[model samples]
Target chain A: MKHVIALDIGSTSTRAALIARDGTVLDHLRRASGHERGAQAVAECVLDFIAELRDRGLRKYGEAARGVGVAVPGAVDEGRGLALFSANLGWRDVPMRSLLSRPLRNLPVALGHDVRSAGLAEARLGAAQDKDRFLFLSLGDGIAGAVVTGGRIESGAHGFGGEFGHLRVRPGGRRCACGAVGCLETVASVPAIAEAWARASGDPTATAVHAARAAAYGAPRATRIWRQAVAAIADAVVAGIGLLDPRTVVVGGELAAVGDILFVPLRAAIAERLTFQAPPEVVPAALRDTASCQGVALLAWDLLAEAQR
Target chain B: MKHVIALDIGSTSTRAALIARDGTVLDHLRRASGHERGAQAVAECVLDFIAELRDRGLRKYGEAARGVGVAVPGAVDEGRGLALFSANLGWRDVPMRSLLSRPLRNLPVALGHDVRSAGLAEARLGAAQDKDRFLFLSLGDGIAGAVVTGGRIESGAHGFGGEFGHLRVRPGGRRCACGAVGCLETVASVPAIAEAWARASGDPTATAVHAARAAAYGAPRATRIWRQAVAAIADAVVAGIGLLDPRTVVVGGELAAVGDILFVPLRAAIAERLTFQAPPEVVPAALRDTASCQGVALLAWDLLAEAQR
Candidate 1:
């Protein structure tokens, strides 16, 4: 059985998986990324993970890995195989595909934006499988999105096609880390939500999970903070609907773990904001963390197929 | 010379042109659309316009029109040749292409959304000709838009992809005609600007042009009103860049005719709002009212080419 290696190089940690061509995860491993050391070290970390995964695949399957796929957080120029900029990885203009494939003899490498890879996974094997057009938004410590059209993610002219979280929802509301005032990220990100809740509830160490628990228990201050974050997210959704007219909106990330506390009011808020626009169905992400792994593996398999042709 | 009939079926009037195969307007005519009569009358008006254009082309140019293209303002299913809805035209689910093509003898007909057709024109021969990705926004008495990518307008899943004006920029600020609160249309449209200026200056008869003149002359009250409208439009641009990351933004319609009074400040405001997102070049529409006519003609030409293949 042929297999492909999918590497999800995240900010804090890296997840590597050996996936069969039929979309099954045969084996997977996770370890700290050591990105704090800088660009070269991060590249080394990804390279080491890929090397280990390839060796494991060769031993277990009696065949060398077919290809390798790397999904990273940031603005990526996929056509040029460059990871342009990633706040989390603290890297710029890193030639990801070339760097990762340098140590291998003839392994083909495919690189893509993390969220877009996950969106591809969702479109093929998860909740958005049937949706021809949808916006997949991941609200974690920060917010990001993937714009899927006609069963493929659009990389846009500059590969910034689906930066929904950077949308200015509250103009003059809060200063964002990206140097913009009142971006959706400033108000609705996981840390932002937790900080807002902590300030309002006078609990210095309150986490987003704590806020969600309190809100679920009908705590007024926690509820207010949650609603504010939901409203901000809803505003971004409404703006997204107007811009993309997606058939569905798939919400993922840690914030979505709050479940009904986030989605219930989000749906209501989006409904209220809509007029002539058709409101898309807002639902939670189905695949969770493994989405990028499967998606990139599929992408690697596609590359291998293309190479054969 | 062979020619095609391009008809722009707008709310108030219908404009038709006999366009040469090489993209020149050979002959043109315009008349009231008679939409106030009924949907059937509107359909007849389009048919009549096409017949006249075909006759003129045969008599003067010595060639019968090969095809017809109709651009209507609404949600159009271009594939099905259906004009799904138009608020100003007060029509719903009209099979425009089929109705118009019924009387013709094997003449292929194409239909498209008016703004999207105009956007196609801009992408091919107008302000956005050099831009591979751009948003064409027309701010008239009402606001509409077209999202052009790779030289074609993206008709989203529901054909509302570029409904930029409907975006909730103010959120609970003003009631839009679409029954939404704080939409960009309610704040920056020509009528909206005129109404705000009229209220502030206590001049009921003041139009958008008058407001522009007053603002240009440094009238304090008019300047304030103009700035407010510009700010709202800038906010919409900021949101657009975050979502589409287009290379350019083409401003059309009556409000864009205000010239530097709008563009000068709009540029500054957008520049201020932008951070990580690339600031797109905002320019005026070059083709003016002739855009839809030219664009539909192109579409008709494309249809003819396709049918031959």
Candidate 2:
């Protein structure tokens, strides 16, 4: 029985999970990212998590795994196995694979974009596993998306294929960190929902989840703001269906916590936008935040399988 | 040399040509589409063209061709080889393969959408030949597009892919024939350009090409309308780039006939909409209205090559 390590580095947290060859979780550990400690320090912390797992595996199974697979946020150069420009995670052009592999005595490591890795997990082990062509959309702190077609995710020319956030939802409305106005992220992401609620309710302390609930329940101000956010999401989703025409559309992240309230209007908005005869299936993501971890595990699992072939 | 008959059926006319195994055009013929003549009449005209080409080829080369290929102007099911619908040509669920195959002694008849067939031609012999991932956009009486990626065109799961006309450009501006509002084709196609010209010169008789030239030379009304049209096209182009991020984008059709008057502003508009990186190389299409015919030729050539393989 062989085992591999899968590390998922996010903006606020660092998580390491040991994935068995059979796709089962053996052990899991979590830690704060403390990204303020700088890139090298944070990476060293990630390495420490891997080392603990490697030692545990060696003591129990009498041998260590051959490699580790990691997933990081933002644009990635999958061919070169690097994470590039994750503004949230404070990482840029980090040779995550090389750094993680070097200290582990030449054990190979694979790196991929977190959202794309999550999409791969869905394609490999979740609801979209049987469906080869679909989109995996995650609306979290900031919005991001990934395209999975014919059993492989499209990484674009620059591995930035699914930056759905900056897609203009409102022309010249909200100025975004990307230096664009009216980006989808400004309207639909978790933080956006909270911000909109603050503006509407004048509370300034409402959580995004609670704000979404108030909006779903049809509070006048909450509903007004929520409707606008949902409308923007629908625009992106509708455009996506028109362009990609996938078999299914799987949505996750913090915004999806509202479930049917979010999907009902989102689906209706998309349907109203289409003039064509056919449309794709829209569904919530099966795995929540843990999806990225599973995706990283799947990547390691694939490498091991490929090596055997 | 083996030869195949290819017919490109458009709204106003039906053009036919004979292509050899080496991709050389043997003979070209033309006929009226006769929208007044109805479906049966149109089918007869196409069949007549193929028969004439077959007889001529046999007389000149002493052999009948292997098969027939027809590129129709509408929705097509390429895998099952069916022309599901055509708004312009008035074709609906036309079992083109069986229809043409029966008359031609049960030989294979390959049927495909004109825009997709044109994209195949561009990918095989035109501007996109050197690129693996590129988008072929055709702007004519209506807008249609095609994606050539990894050397294969994406036909969508239900054969409804590349319908770029329906992409919402202005959001709640004008109702389109496709039932969507603010569709790119509503404001950027040949009719749109012609409409702008008519408004500018106060001459409803002014053609799209002439109007484009007038606008390029600084006619205020023409410039205003043309600028709006350019901005709309740029928005749609940016949207497409954002979604697919292809390496190259090839533009053709009636709008392209405007030449540099169209390309210059259109390119600048697309550039203005881009952000944080490389805009794709936008160029004029190498193949013209005869694109579908050549693409049909490529299909026949592909079939013949595959048979040899």
Candidate 3:
């Protein structure tokens, strides 16, 4: 049973998984991805984490790991095996594959963007099964998205694609991290929802889960704020459907935790605006948080198989 | 040498062609369609137009047509080979395949939207050749678009997809036929451009072509209004890239006639807003007004070949 090791390096944590040829998770582990002091420390910690995973695998299944796949936060050159930029991890032009492969005794390594990896997971194993032409929206921190069409995550020509959060839904509404204004992330993203709820209800730590729970009993502020955020998301989704005509849309990240309370209004708003656009099947992501790690595992599987072929 | 008859029934006229196995037009003809009368008249006109084309084909290639392909504007049900709606042509719930097949010998008929046919044409022979992931935008009497990804046009779950021009770009700008406010067509489309130019220049009969010519020579109002329109288009394109991440964007219809005068600025606008969108090659549509007709011809080719297979 040939397999690949998948690693998703986030700002605060790292997720690792060993994926089998049949798309099953052989084993999985998680560890801290030291983001406190910047690039070098985090990179070294990641390399150690992956090495430890390999050691654990060797102890149990001995040389079963065919390769390793890593999902980074920012721009990456998977073909060139380089991390162009990772803002959260504070890395630039790091030869990630070389760093890990050299220490792992020349094992093959694949690298990809985090959202893209999650999109691959959705296409291969989740709600987008048996279909392509979809958008995998990662709605946390700041909103970013990955396009999956024909089983290929669309990487823009210049590695500047799927920046969905910067589409300026409100033109000049809110200041965003990307130096843009009123992006969907600013209003409809999970953090935005929490912030809006806090500002509206005078509770700074409000969240999507808290709002949904409150709205169940018809809390006025929670209902108003949540509906606004959901409608905003619907606007972005409608714009998405208009442009791409995706067959399915899978919403992931912290926003998905709100479950059907969010989905019910989201679906209605989308249906209302979808007069002439392709009405895609809006659904929740199945794999949850570790999806991108698993997806990156699939990338490693591809690399391993291609090397053999 | 089996073929399909593609009858593109539009508001003002009916066009029919005998498409060969390789998407070549063996022969074609055109005639006026119908008006305030009824769908029965329109159906009869379509029949007569096809008979004329069939006769012309015998005169030119000395052969009868095989299968059938038809592209109708409005909500098409390509899955069931039906036209669910056609506001312009006054068609609703029209069993187009059966009606058009009455002229032929009941050969197979594949139906799609007109812009989708153009997208198929671009995918096969035009600017989007060899590129499966792309979009075809047409600026005509009304604005509409089609999406081609992975060698297929997305007819959507209900056959209404790729309506970018209809997406609400402005929340409270203009009234659209679909009862939407400030759609892309209301600002950046041919009518939008012409209306903008007319209002800015105080000329009632000013056309988009006139506006482009003036803007090319550095007319102040023309430049201001045209730039706004171009900027709006760019904004929409950026959002599209965020969602679709297509590699090529083919612009068709009258506005493309301005050549670089239109494309150069439009490309710059799309480039400015992009962060990580697939580097889409923005170019004028290769096929002209007959692009969709040619796309239907490609479908005609595919349908006939599949029948033989």
Candidate 4:
């Protein structure tokens, strides 16, 4: 079957997958991202990983992969096919598409933002399937979001459209790393919750998962920290709803893994805060960790489709 | 000269215009909206106004108007051609398009929200011309907004998109008419500022314009009230910037008449608040009060083009 090679490169790990035209994952692979080595080394590592995936796909399918799609964290100039300024990867204006294409003998390559790519995957094949308008939020180490309208992500005028992490939910509250006070990321991001829980519970290793478990069991301190995080998230979501009026809010990331513990309070908090704004169904992401891989694969297929046209 | 008829119906007055294909207002007329008389009376008045404009168009141009577009305040279901609800008009489920169509022997009628239509006009021919993405804010008796992306307004899933006024900016600060606390409208809307200024200055007839003038002159009380309004508006605009990252923000309606007094501080406040998000060019609305009429005219032309297609 005709297929594409997809890669989601993060700070800690690189996930590679073979995606068919129908979005099926024919095969998957994972490896260290090697970003700590240096930007040049990370680039070389990515090229090598792509080469390995390509050789495997050629040998197994008896043909070459049609395209390559890579999802990278941080600022991206998707129109220019440049991975611009990723602090995690320590790269600046890396011509990722061209780099991938040269080794693959001119295969079409699509580069996308990691969170946005994941959002596209969700919109097409996961929780938001058939939903033309919705907000996709990833509450990982930091919060990120994508506004999907007409089944396409809005990349904004300068490709910075969905910077939901820095939205100031509390006036003059916690200082965010982005130099803003009361940013949603400072209160509701996975690490933020984990840190709060760790301090409050006096357990150095207490994570957000532990906090959620404790909150679910009705522990006082954990429940307080969990509720604060949930309220902050609801504030940001309500702001999104007011601006976009999305029908669904598909949440993905580490916090989302807590399932009903996060969603139940999130829905109620959002509902309680809303007066005139339409309440969107706050649902957990369906694709889990493979979302970016599947999403970039879909981008590859789209590139091929556009080329055909 | 081929043209379209356009009308903007507000609570107190209705403005009508003759618009050329290139978005010029050939002629204009105004009349009392008579909405206080009842929804039926308002509907009858609308039909009569359209008939008058149609007859005038035929007499002046020796041809019938190809289409008509009406901009109304309140909830609108543009896809279904229904004005779902308008508290100002005291109407519900008004089949506006069909009502206008039946009387004019089935002339095409396009229905749209007042602020959104104004935003469309701004995007096409006014302040935001050539801007594919921007936020259009109208600060009148109440605040309303439109999210224009790719040169079209995002009406949301349930026709409630772009309700920017209700966004919680202060968080538990003021009770809004919409039953929400700290809504942007509560602090920055025309009447809100006016109320604050009136109370502080002990002038019963004081308006937002008086406060702006006094603030410009550096009057202490007026300046305080004005600063509060500007800060609140800046907060809401910053939230919009974080979410959509628009290229421009076009401010209109009554408060915008203050010009430099509002724009100068607003730009500074927004700049101060923004950390990592791209700062959009905040500008005054070029079309002023006639934006809705021109926008509906554009919509009418669009309907005619679609019919030919």
Candidate number with greatest DockQ: 4
Clash list (residue pairs), candidate 1: none
Q: Across residues B106-215, which tens digit of lDDT does each residue of candidate 2 receive? A: 55678877898888888877889878777788988888888666677877776766777777878877888878888888888888778767876788887777767778
Question: For residues A1-309, what per-residue lDDT tens digits would candidate 4 score against the true structure?
Answer: 788999999989999999999888999999999898876677689889988888999999987889999998877767788887675578777888787677677788899888999999999899999998999999998788899876768877777778888899988899988888999999988788889999999999999899999999999999999999999999999999998889999999988998999999999999999886668888999987889989989988999999999
The CAPRI classification for model 2 reads as medium
lDDT of 1 by residue, B265-296 (tens): 99999998877666788999997777888888
lDDT of 1 by residue, A1-309 (tens): 789999888888889899888778888899998999987888888888877877888899898888888888878877788888887788888888888788776998888888888888888888898898899999888798888765667766666778888988886698888887788899889899889888988889988878877988999988888888888899998888887788999999888888888888899999987876777999999887878888888888889898899
Please state every model's RMSD to the true fold in angstroms. 1.9, 2.2, 3.5, 1.7
Worst 10 residues of 1 chain B by lDDT: B147-156
When only the first chain is scored, the TM-scores of the models are 0.95, 0.94, 0.93, 0.96
Docking quality of model 3: it rates as acceptable
Residue range A162-275, candidate 3, lDDT tens digits: 767767778758887666567887887777777777787788777767876777679998888777777778888888777666788898888777788878888998898766
User: lDDT tens string, model 2, A97-172?
Assistant: 7777788776768887788888887777776879967888898888878876666687776667777787776776
User: What range of 10 consecutive residues in model 4 chain B has the weakest lDDT sum?
Assistant: B97-106
Docking class of predicted structure 4: high
Query: Compared with the real two-chain complex, what DockQ does model 1 have?
Result: 0.71
lDDT of 1 at A111: 89
TM-score of chain B, candidate 4?
A: 0.96
The TM-scores of all predictions, comma-separated, are 0.95, 0.94, 0.87, 0.96
Error of 3 at A126 (Å): 3.0
